[model samples]
Target: AAAGWPLSELFDRQFASWLDLDPALDATNRVPSILNGGLGKISPVYWGACLGAAAAIDLYGLRKKRSDPDYFPGKLGFDPLGLYPSTTTGKRRMELAEIKNGRLAMIAITGFAFQEFVQQYAVVDQTPLLFKPVSDVVETYGSIGGYGM
Candidate 1:
């Protein structure tokens, strides 16, 4: 929940605007205030509420997971969709797949953050292939000149 607002804003074409928010990019100490500033533009009370919700979820999940020995983190009490397999091997495979996918997503997000930091450009604008079927963008913008090649 804490990441939802920033992720939404970034995906909604506010990626460039983030440069205006933290140009130097060294103000790690003021993350809360920065988050509040951006969130305040949409809703004055969103920041605190989101923080509270994140804290509550963290606390509740930790407590609940600790209390239940057999309760898997992703398992629903009742799988109405029957997506989960009954076999232990199938369950372990699903867990491993979930972890791997989560790790892949985290890596992608980290790469996006680094790209934004160094390039100071929106990933969508840089990644033309995502929005259209164009090869010229990669040809024109993929040069290594900016890295002093």
Candidate 2:
């Protein structure tokens, strides 16, 4: 249980660190390192290839599902990237697609890390927290004056 706790704590800390990193830095630095180093600890090249393949599959699926009317303005169909006008309806569809796909991808990737963390720290009893959850810890020492002591 003690061993598991530390592993859980480490995972929680690392995850919080990743969340706090700047988006640009995350892309250029943290992401590759975590994906390659953390996940890579299990399997490096395999995970990297999996990430690339997943993205490609997502792009291909999106391209294949595009409607004819979505690509063609009146009668002429645009072949280059098949980009259409960004109307309210179009924007809404795009947003929905992105949200749906993004969520699935996030879940999939996070699930992998979570499994690894649990496996690595199977003996731990308590999980780590980014911040203290108890109110007393956050409150001032002198501020416990209200109500009944």
Candidate 3:
């Protein structure tokens, strides 16, 4: 309403994109209701909390892992920092390494948050959306980082 950019079109495009993304659920047949089609509406709040936690970790500390080679999964060949020190040296290299590590960690955190939301909210009762039934496993059986059931 205030700006030149059309917010309506932005939402419409997102709606169309999601509808198209899931071939099983098309825009023609599917629409929001009391229970369903509200997936994108409600989950972002919770997901943002999860990502925020990751951001906080990066901002605060636990950066000891940045310099520690044993911290990263070298055995798995996953060098998150990519801090070879050949291209960059001294403080800049370390800064870049930390930034890189932080990004990778954030990605992992976001993905975990997405899955956690899906497991907690997406699948209902006992049935899972797919295999390896994670339905309420965390809330019912286990807890993450002392987040008990």
- lDDT tens per residue, model 2, 80-121: 776644598985676577678778777655654464344432
TM-scores for the candidates: 0.55, 0.26, 0.24
Instruction: Report how far off residue 104 is in candidate 1 (Å).
Output: 1.3
Cα-lDDT of candidate 1: 0.53
RMSD of each: 7.6, 14.8, 17.6
Candidate 2 Cα lDDT to native: 0.44
| lDDT, each prediction | 0.53, 0.44, 0.43
On a 0 to 1 TM-score scale, where does candidate 3 land against the true structure? 0.24
Task: Give the candidate number with the greatest TM-score.
Answer: 1
1 versus 3: better lDDT goes to? 1
Name the better of 2 and 3 by TM-score. Answer: 2
**Model 1: per-residue Cα lDDT over 4-116, one tens digit each:** 42344334334436645433222221122232232233344655798999888777767778888887676435578878878999989988998888887777766656654
Find the candidate with the highest lDDT and give its number: 1
